[model samples]
Target: MWSGPRNLSTAMMYAFAARGDCAVWDEPFYAAYLKATGIDHPMRQEIMTAHDADPDRVAAACRGPAPDGQAIFYQKHMTLHMIDGFDRGFMRDCTNVFLIRHPARVVASYAQKREGPTLADIGFVQQAELFDQVADWLGRAPAVIDSHDIRTNPRDALESLCHTLQLPFTERMLSWPAGPKPFDGIWASHWYNAVHASTGFGAPEGPLPELAADYRRLVDQAMPYYERILRESGRNPNSPA
Candidate 1:
C-alpha cells in the first residue's frame, strides 16, 4: 500500500494484519528517507536509530521472502519517503495499491499534526509519479482506493479492492483491536495517536475542513495530481451503494 500521511493508512495496515496469513510492514523506507534528506521531522533521531536507515538493505528486504514464512507480505509505504536516491526496483515484485484522499482533507489533517506542509511534504506529486511508474511498468494503471470510500463503507470498498488484488475479502480487514501493533515504526508516538485510539475506520469524514489561505494554496497545488490519480481510482464514496 502506498499513501501519504493521515490517509487511513495505519488503519488499513491494522486491518490487513488482522488477517492471520499476512505479515505487515509499516513504512520501511521512512528512516532512509529522513537520513538521506536530513529533514527535521519529529522523532527523526529516534526513528533513524530504531529502524534500519540503509535504503539498499531496506529494498533488499522488501524484495525478499515474507518474514517468518507468512503467505502474504503487506507493506505500508509512504510515497514521500521514496526519495530520489532510493531504488524503486523492489516494487516490481509486489502488488501496488495507491491510497488517496482529497487534497483539502489531506492538507487539513496533516496541518493538525505537523505545521506548514508543502506540496512535497503531503506527497501528491510523488504519488502520481509512482503511480505512473508502476502503470508504465505494467502497461496499465494499478489498483487505487480512496480513503473516503474506505471510511464510508469499508466492506464494499475493501471487498472491491480485494477482488482487484485477487485476494478473498475477509471481515478481518474491517477492524482490529485498538492500540499500536508490534510493527509500527518508532515515529508512531508522534504520528499515530488517533489511529491508536480507534478499533476501525472512523465515522465518514465531515465536510472537508476549512483551510487557511496558504494551506488552501497548497491544496490547490496538490489538486491536479490528486484528480489525475482519482480518475483512475474507480471507487467513489458518494456513489450509491
Candidate 2:
C-alpha cells in the first residue's frame, strides 16, 4: 500500500500482517529516503544505521523475492519516500494501492510529533503524483481507500480493497496481536505507540485538528491536491473530510 505518514498506514499494515497467507514489509525504502533527502524526521540517525541507505539497492530488493517465500508480499510504503530519481518502474511488478486520510487530520497528527510539516513532509503532493502516474500506466485507476472508511467501517472498506486487489477477504485481517511485530521498521519505536496498543482499527479520534494559522494555511494549500485525488479515484464519495 502507498501511504503517507500518520494515515493509519501502520494499522493497515498490521491488518495485512495478520493474514496467514500474506507477509508484510514496513517502509522498506525509509532509510534510503532519509539518506537521500536528509529530511530531519525523528530517529534519523538510528533509522539510517539500521537499514540499507542506497535507494537503488532498496529498489532491487523490493523487486526481488518475497521474504520467507510467502505467497503474497504486502509492502506498506510511504509515497513521500519515492524521492526524485527513485525508480518507480518496480511498482508495475506488484499491485499498487493508495491509502489516504484528510489533510487536516494528517497535518494535525504529524505536527504533534514534529513541527513545521510542509506539504511534501505530509506526503499529499507525492501521493497525488504517484496516484496519477499509476493510473496512467495501468490505463485504469488503482485502488484508493480513505482512512476514514477503514476506521469507520473496516469490513466494508477492506472487502472493497480485497476485491480491487483480487485478494481474499479474511476475517483474520480484521484483528491482530496487540504489540510490535517482527516486520515493523526500527523507526516504529518512535511512531507506533497507538498501533502497538491496538488489536483492531480503533474509533475515530476526537475531532480533526483545529490548526493554528500557519498549519491551517498548509491545510489550505493541500486541500486541492487531496480533492483532486478523490475526484480521480471516485471512491468513498461519502467519506468525511
Candidate 3:
C-alpha cells in the first residue's frame, strides 16, 4: 500500500498478515533506498535495527517465487519514498493499494513513536505533495481508508478491502490465529502497541495524545483532498491506513 509517514500503514500490513495467506513484507523498498541513497530517517533506523539487518537486501531476498504460491503479498510503502533520486523499482509489476489516515493522527502517532518530525512538522503543503506522488501510483481513483474508521471497524473495513482487491473475505482476514509471523518493519514494536492491544476493531479513535490542536489545523488543511479521495475510493467510509 502507498502511504505517508506516521500512518498505521504497518499495522494494516500486520492485519493483512493476520489473515494468514498473505506473505507480508514491511517497507521492502526502505532497505533498497537506504542502500542506494545512503540517507536515513529516524523511523528508518528503528526499522533496520533488527538482528537480521539490511531490510533493503531482505526485501530482495523475498524477490523470488511466492510463498505457498497462493498467498497475497502485502508491502508497506511510504509516500516520501517515491521522491526524486529515490528508487522507483518497487512501483512496477504490482497492483496497488493506497491507504491514508487523517494527517492529524499520523502526526500524533509520529510524536508517540519517534523524536523526529511531527505530521505538522512537515507542513500541509509538503504532506500534500507526498500524497500527490502516492496518489499518482494508487490512481486518483484507488482504494483509500481513513485511520479513524479502521480503528472503529476492521471487519467491514477488511471485507470491503477484499472486494476491492477482488479477493475473498475469509474469517482469517478478520483475525489472526496463533502462530509466528515476521512483521519486520522498522517501527513495528514502537508503533504497534495500540494494534496489539486490540481484540477487535473498536470506536474510531480520537486524536492521539497531545496532537489535538495540530490535528485540527491539519484536518482543515487536508480535509478537501482527503474527502475527495473518500468519495472516489468506493470503500467504506472507514478503512485502515
**Backbone clashes (count) for model 1:** 0
**What TM-score against the true fold does each predicted structure earn?**
0.96, 0.96, 0.70
Best by lDDT: 1
> Could you give the C-alpha RMSD of every candidate to the true structure, in order shown?
1.9, 1.4, 4.7
Model 2 misplacement above 4 A: 236-239
Residue pairs in candidate 3 whose N, alpha carbon or C atoms collide under 3 angstroms: 31-56, 32-56, 47-186
Minimum summed lDDT over a 10-residue window in model 1 is located at 232-241
Assess candidate 3 and give its lDDT.
0.59
Model 3 Cα lDDT, one tens digit per residue, 1-241: 7777656665677677777677776666565555545665556655445423454444454453556663677777665544455434444455666676765566666666654453334333433455455567656655566666666777777887789789888766555533333565645565566666654455677544455664566556665555555655554434443
Pick out the ten consecutive residues of candidate 3 with the lowest summed lDDT: 118-127
Candidate 1: segments with Cα more than 4 A from true spot: 234-241
Best of the two (2, 3) by lDDT: 2
Clashes of each: 0, 0, 3
Which portions of model 3 show Cα errors greater than 4 Å? 32-64, 68-70, 115-140, 177-181, 207-225, 231-241
